[model samples]
Target: MSKSGDDQVRYEPAAPKKEQGGAQKPASQKSRPLLEYSPVYLLVTIMLTLFTAEWLIMIILNMAPGIPQEWATLINALALTVVIFPVVYFFHYRPKVRDLAELKRVSLVLTESERRIRSVMEATNDSIIQINEKGLIVFWNRAAEALFGYTAKEIMNKKFLTLVTSPRYYVFFEKWFRNELDLVKKNHGDSMGQGQFEVFIKRKNEKVIPVEVSLSSVWLEDSLHTICMVRDITIRKKAFVALKESEKRFREALEKVCMVTAQVEANGKIMFCNDYFLRVTGWEKKDVLGRNLFALFIADKFHAALKKRLYESIAMRVEIKQMEQEIITRSGDCRLVMFNTTNLLDHKGRVIGVTIIGEDITERKKSEEIKKESNERLRKANEELQKAQTQLVRSEKLASLGHLAAGVAHEIRNPLNIISTSIQLLSMEERLSPETVKTSRIVMEQVKRASKITENLREFAREKKPEIIKMDLHDFLERTIALVEYEMSLENITVVRNFNSGPIYLLGDEDQLAQVFLNVIGNARDSMNEKQEEFSYDELQKRGWVGQLVIETIVNEHMAGVRFRDTGVGVTRETKEKIYDPFYTTKREGKGTGLGLAIAYGIIENHGGRIEIESDVGEGAEFSVFLPLATERNA
Candidate 1:
């Protein structure tokens, strides 16, 4: 072999380099050929040797006369093929084969390394999870199965937000990220460094555990992978919580607040309640912990409802007002309290617990209630004063009516006296003119009409005791109608009875009931005056000038009621309010004496019955009357 080992011209086996101390590369990789053993030299040497040998052999063969030229050519070809093929194939072609084997070895090493890594990941005891920057779980490992009561298959390919009772943190992240992008837009700088933050994770059971982690970005092929590493510190958290409780009383006292102290989980459960809580609930410490906050401090019927609302509020990351709520104190006192609830969130904006503050407002409520009752009594006294004033006005109007009636009566009576004496004298003469007799008779008729006016005024003034009897209300209505039927016919008013079919019972005097009916019907007729033309009334024919009047009776077991509604010209809202007062009317002075409705109102009130009137300017008027049934009245 050549000293440099390059002239050997064979593919050398891999041999470890002999070195001092430090490692060295194999000979196959580091060794190189000498200048004489170059690829070009090897090729030239073979060619030149073949050329020289062939010439010598050809010369020797020529001297053999017995050999044919074609046979000589064939023998030279065979010899050249045997020797030249072995040298060129071994030195030149075999190195290419070595290169192919080396490539396979490298590929095998890469595959083995990948397999070992995969095995370690699957075998790890602690949960090895992969999540995107959005906090969605990309992978779940066996360690996760042991820690959380979920299989890897259950969590794979799902967002980490699914296990959380409230997903507000996710929403916050999206908002924060958007804000970061906005910052990037404004400054045109990399926001990736500033945007990364740790987020708390909640388990499927609604236990929120703080985690320590960071974000990393990788370019895999042409895609980006954002990864995070998470660890559960629930035990550490509980220890920290216990320590806080040990210090809460001291802190609250130092803070100079009498507010009841409590520790609620992020999901709104009461984990620990202070001595104040036990005092309020009337229960020992055992009764407070492990109970939903809503149950301990609120009504049972709304527990399910409040739970849902609370969850939604947490999801939205909002605080709730502790409005007035009832709570059973430890002393069995159910007191009303006004409460305020605020969320306790972490640095990452994750809800850790709810903080509630409540104050008793019952005494304040009682004082306000007493003030309300006093005001109501004062209001009732004022209404009675108003009624008394109305009575005085009605009494004055009656005195005026009496004076008018006396004057009218005197004027008619003087003329009637003259006519009557004249008629008697004429009759004695036995030859009286027909006109004279007619004149006397006409004067008498006018006097009688004046007297009728006097009679109506007297009837209005009269106050009579009711005569009680079991009578059909319908018959009473009919009799009253008959009295006014002639007047109605003259006015063309149509009376409609949605009147109940009954031996409709009532306890009342016939005369008093008649008086009541007279005033009510008279008032209705007066209202129809404006609609006379519309109802086709012609005073000459005594035709249909009256509007429809509906009287409806409603009977219930405890009471018998009647509703009288009219389609006549309705009263205005202002007039309707004062319609039941004495001497209130829209009729002209000569046309009506306004005592009719006033008298009706008084009579119904004296009977312990109520009349309710509902009317608007154009919608017409309805009046309902209610009186207790006879049996109820006796009771």
Candidate 2:
């Protein structure tokens, strides 16, 4: 009725509470006896009885001697009117009217209270419900309807426990409700006659939601009632779980990081450090916390520079990156560290501290120092070695040239002596005979032979530059193969061509490459022919030996290659090593000059190519010539 500063009014929608007893029976059953007694009819019957008694009394008086019937009747009527009417009207009828008026007033007040309660319940965000002692739902508000997905009509008169309890929570509700009822009954009208708890309620859609509930008990019409104020806590629960998970992930990340990470105050006091920082610094977290970071860890030489950087980073808000410095550890050993530092800011963007992330680079620094020293040593050693190798190569070249000159002179002298003898023989005759004419022709042949040797020597001595051109290696190999086909066939040799269809271009002197191929192919054919002479065709077939030359064209990332292989007696290791040397021929006298391979080697070298030979004593030899792939510049 009165509002106070400290007191607040709260409205709860009244619903039937679950009780130990069963559901409330209908009002008709309780009102049946009262209806039978009908007060209006009872009053009428009493008046009739009084009137009948008066009439009888008047008759008796009239029948008696010396009595007046009219007088008796009048006297009885007066008595009835005066005593009975006043008594009935004042005591019964007036009281009934007054009681009815009081009942109407109370009903109006109850209705107004209920209407206010409903308005408050609907206005509040929380779902409110009141349950009565009979376990029947007497109230369901708009908030409750929205929360539970059931309208007030649908939920009204239903048992409270039926809406909230499932089989899973039946035992829990039973115990909880028993306890709550005990409290409500024991503290019937106490100020703190309430209990709060959390439970899950299933909505009409069968969706379960967690709710925080505050309960209050009140006496309504001499019966116990329980009010529940429920709030949905799903969002709060999710946020709490997320915060806990975020904390866990933060701790895990700090533990897993490999670098040293630390936070420091602007004054260089260490505020926090991760696991790696503690381990790397050889200090416990407690030992390092609140200590001056630079004084404890940084070497003295870097103190000034680091302090300057720290000041700049915090004051100017500049980040220092990849600063290489040395820090002394607890064991008094200096470690090289590469660290980056940035200012840590507060919500207002004011610098609060600094964060330092560093990696231990001591071992790397040592390795770099060692590598630098070793590189210096290796460079000096290499220079000296190169000089010595150069001198040795020059000496060997001179010696080889001297030997070649001697061989050339000896070879030429033989032909020259033969020509001289032939000339002398022809000069002795004025009219030369047939023998003399033959001697003259022999002289001419010897001179031609000497000239041919000179020409080969000249070619060997000259250095020819390659006129580089872009050409398909396969096509070149095919053309070279055609030139040697007839020769190989004459020796009963089979030339097997293995060439990829794709074009493999190389920058080279095509003429020089052709000459190289021709020389190699000629050697292959010669080798096979020499082998054929050693074994009969049928015998060679029986031995599974065939005069075969395999020419394979191959390409790789940097070079294109052509392989020349011959199925003949391979050269010995000793002869193979010297096969590319000048004047080293295995051919019979006058059949070869031994300059073909030497020229091939020089030509390939000038074209920036490599010629590699693979051979065994019994197996055939393979010569792979690799020329660099042509580039746009070379083309």
Report, for every candidate in turn, its global Cα lDDT versus the true structure. 0.64, 0.76
Candidate 2 segments exceeding 4 Å error: 1-434, 437-443
lDDT of 2 by residue, 468-522 (tens): 8888787777787888698668778999988867888888888888889899988
Q: Which ten residues in a row have the lowest lDDT in candidate 2?
A: 25-34
Instruction: Report the poorest 10 consecutive residues by lDDT, candidate 1.
Output: 1-10
On a 0 to 100 scale, what is the lDDT of residue 526 in model 2? 80
Best by TM-score: 1
* TM-score (C-alpha, index-matched) for candidate 1: 0.52
Backbone clash numbers for all candidates listed:
12, 10
